[model samples]
Target: MNRKSRWAAGPYILWMIIFVIVPLVLIGVFAFTTDAPFDENSKRLTQEELAAIEEEYAETDEELPVTYKTVFTWDNILSVSQYLPVLFNSAWLALIATAICLIIGYPLAYFMSRFRASSQRLVQMLIMLPMWMNFLLRTYAWMTLLEKNGWINRIFGLIGVGPFEMINTQGAVVLGMVYNYLPFMILPLYSVMTKIENHTIEAAQDLGAGSIRVFTKVVIPLSMPGIASGITMVFVPAVSTFIISRMLGGGTNMLIGDLIDLQFLGNAYNPNLGAAISLVLMVFILLCMSITNQLDNGDEEMEGKML
Candidate 1:
């Protein structure tokens, strides 16, 4: 707000311009532009050719050509039909993964926050240690572990049990998502739970409230912000995830991320349609973020009221 603050913030402003603003502008431009002609030999317009085209357009144009449109024609929209299944599958799998993450991660985080201090540091280190390993290697490791005749089934065979199938299932997709994102859910929830003041719990007990009542009235309410953040962190990536789904699921599970990848790399060469699907996915991500923000701000307002 002041000159001193402006001076301090100048570097951050410049960094945002270079990193955040520039990438967004590029994505925005690409989202509007039609896919380029792949058949063209040179794969790029020459400077002189570009200048001639610009001159032709500028010289006799009755009205300016439409640069972009918010709403695309039905034909253009229909072109994105190939990605519908992928989009729906992504949404479903991510929702399931988010639920699983909360179910498992919440209890683990609560225990670590409540009982373990020195152990908590060690566990946190172990969780983050996976980051040191290559991500694709970790994912491939899951593939090995979950394949029909993989380690678990081999062990089962030794005990006279039949082979089991795990890989290439929806379950594997969820498992991969949960494994990759559990730490994200845990850390935020742990931070919030650990920061909770003990006096509030004591006050609830002093008023003869039971443990469940105290948790419901105090703990859950106080931890809402952390829970909201965890959901966002897990949900967004899980929904857009191609890496885990493609590796674990193979061709069986078609996720939105896989569709985008296919458009870019596989048989489908429709970049414009891919961009359309991407724009839709971006809208969905924004919707999730907006919901999280509202819940976060609402919790803050409620806390102020309590104070």
Candidate 2:
């Protein structure tokens, strides 16, 4: 709040302006610009040179005058409709992964929160252990396990069930998203759940509430912040994931992330389109966060009214 505090924040302000704000501005510029760069050489040509070239070419009709300046265009953004399938696939899969994480994570967090402090610490560490490894390496390990002759199939063989196709499927991609993002869901829930005092739940039960009623009416409403945070953490990355779908889904189940990658780096090689896709994805994520915030705010209001 003082001059010294303002000075301390200078570096962070400069860092955000340079890295975050500038890049977003550039992406916005690129998204609205034509893919082709303006050719300065064409502008530099003299009228005489142009006339000579036209005469040599001997066109049957008058050629339209062309400008050699970059112009804003909406084609890149509008073209996103062509990739609707990929976009839908990404949204649908990300939603499934987020739902799965919530369903599995809430109960896990609730159970873990009831443990002693020492045991809770151990459980938290165990939940976070897999995250210490590189994400790419972890996804690759899943690929190895899901492949035709992978460990899963070997286990199935021992059970006389033989191998079933697992890798290169939509289910595999969703599984990878859930596996990687589950901890994001669990940690937030666990943190919030641990902060809930036992007295609150006891009071709810004393009021003749059943276990489900206590959880729904007391525990869940209190933990809405964590639920919102976890959903955002899990859903955003799952929606934008390219590597998991590429490696585990074998490139067959292309998501919006893959479409964006292809535009910038793959055969498509269109940065303008990539920027457009990125902008749309950013808007979608912001919308999701906004909805989550509304839900969290509603829960807080309801909790206040109850109190």
Candidate 3:
């Protein structure tokens, strides 16, 4: 690159190193570090206790057990079983939410793409409008709307459905995820669909392909890149999001993010475990991105074949 371009990128690279790269490195280090909670009478060393030992290792007591020794032991790695359930649950929830978003968002995106410019602008405005307000506020608003005695329940009561529970359920968690991430799905798909060649669709129809055939064999294939992009955008954040899950799903819905939070701030007090979980989460997202990129490449190959 030219000198000016290199200079322009220098600040961003430095900032990234100072902020993102440094924090990630620290997290990885802490992941490997020993971290356990303090116990007044317990014979075992906690994570915090282990960290303290390393920090004060220079104090020199040949009698005291090695802090780094126990901290990086095989037993500690095996102890990650406690976090597995949460990780599994988080993955399951994210997959379900992504599938639901794909189903709903594809249709909306298609509609938005096919509509007139003025109408499309209005629809886009409606979709983007929710983002103007705080996301947490929107989740809280849904809580109020879905509570047993909330607006929906009151309407149901009039029809004799009476006291239907909505808040604090798995359904509530899914609802929050879909509500928050639907736009991510729609926007990508819409952008792809809007750029789709009108002539190709018409040509397919002219060649005796029905509407369904045209959609499935032509439009859908062309839109695969957008679909993959949307899924990655929605699924990654959904897996790591704790706020909506905590507020909507309540006690029953325990996700990986919640477990990570508890490790750092809650009862777990094992920042090592939190760091481990975060690293694992990053790996999962990397996998998702890899799959999406593969799909995008496949789409490009197919597009090349079509041309």
Candidate 4:
């Protein structure tokens, strides 16, 4: 690479080092280390009692007596088993939402790609309009709409269908995820579909292939990159989201993100466990993306072999 190109990449490399690498290093540090009381008596106290004692010490100016020993331990990582259920549930919901987004977005994307330039722009604008608003506000709107006495139930009442319990449920969480991330799926697929050669699809039709065959064999194969990208884009955020599950799922549907937040930022003062949870979540997300990438590559390999 030339000097100009190297210089251009310098800021990006610096940014990664400062933000990404530094945070990962901090998480590892916190995950693996814990403060053990140097005083034997302090170690014997319950966490609550210990906190009370610490508070008492803090209120007085006298150089708080005992120091804590920074000990390395596997307790934090081992404790993750207790949270496995929440983690698994988060993964399941994320997969459901991602699959729904793919099912809905693919058809919309294909149709959008077939439209004229002006019509295409209008559709793109509509798809992206929701995203221009605050994420929290969008979720709040859904929350209001799903309430028992909300506009949706009122409309249902008019139809004589009666009100239904829509808010604070697993279905609500999945709905929020799909609503928020559907555009991610559609845009990528649309971008890829627009680049697909009209001649290739025509060639399939010219061979005695029907519409279904042309779609399943030709168009779908060409759209694999978009499928992979969309899945990654939707799945990662959906799995880690606490707000959607908290607001829509009424905090009953606890996710990995919620657990981590509780440990770190909530009343619980356990950064160690939070960091470990964060590390595990990062691993799971990477594994998911890797599997997706492998599938995409396998598709490419199969296509190449056929060629």
lDDT to native, each model: 0.80, 0.90, 0.85, 0.92
lDDT score of residue 58 within candidate 2: 75
lDDT of 1 by residue, 1-307 (tens): 5667768888999999999998776555555665332212433444466556567779774543323223323443466666677677788899999999999988887777776678878887887788678878988999998888899788889999968778998999999999888888988998899888678789999999999999888888888888999999899989998899889998789888888787778798766666667777888889889988998898889889989
**Poorly placed runs, candidate 2 (over 4 Å):** 35-68
Candidate 1: list runs displaced more than 4 Å.
1-19, 35-78, 304-307
lDDT of 3 by residue, 1-307 (tens): 5667778888899999999999999877777767434334545665677677666765776434542232453333456676788788888888899999999999989989889989988998899899788999999999999998999999998999879779999889989999999999999999999998789999999999999999999989989989999999999999999999999998679888887888899987887778878887888789878988998899889879889
**Predicted structure 4, TM vs. truth:** 0.90
* RMSD each, Å: 7.9, 4.8, 5.6, 3.3
Model 1: colliding residue pairs? none
**Which rank order by lDDT, best down to worst?**
4, 2, 3, 1
In model 4, which regions exceed 4 Å deviation?
Answer: 1-15, 40-65
Q: Which predicted model would earn the best lDDT?
A: 4
User: Worst 10-residue stretch by lDDT in candidate 1?
Assistant: 64-73
TM-score of each: 0.79, 0.88, 0.84, 0.90
Off by over 4 Å in 3: 35-77, 304-307
**lDDT score at residue 115, model 2, on the 0-100 scale:** 98
Query: Scored by Cα lDDT, where does model 3 land?
Result: 0.85
RMSD of 2: 4.8
Report the error of model 3 at residue 263, Å. 1.7
Candidate 1 TM-score over all chains jointly: 0.79
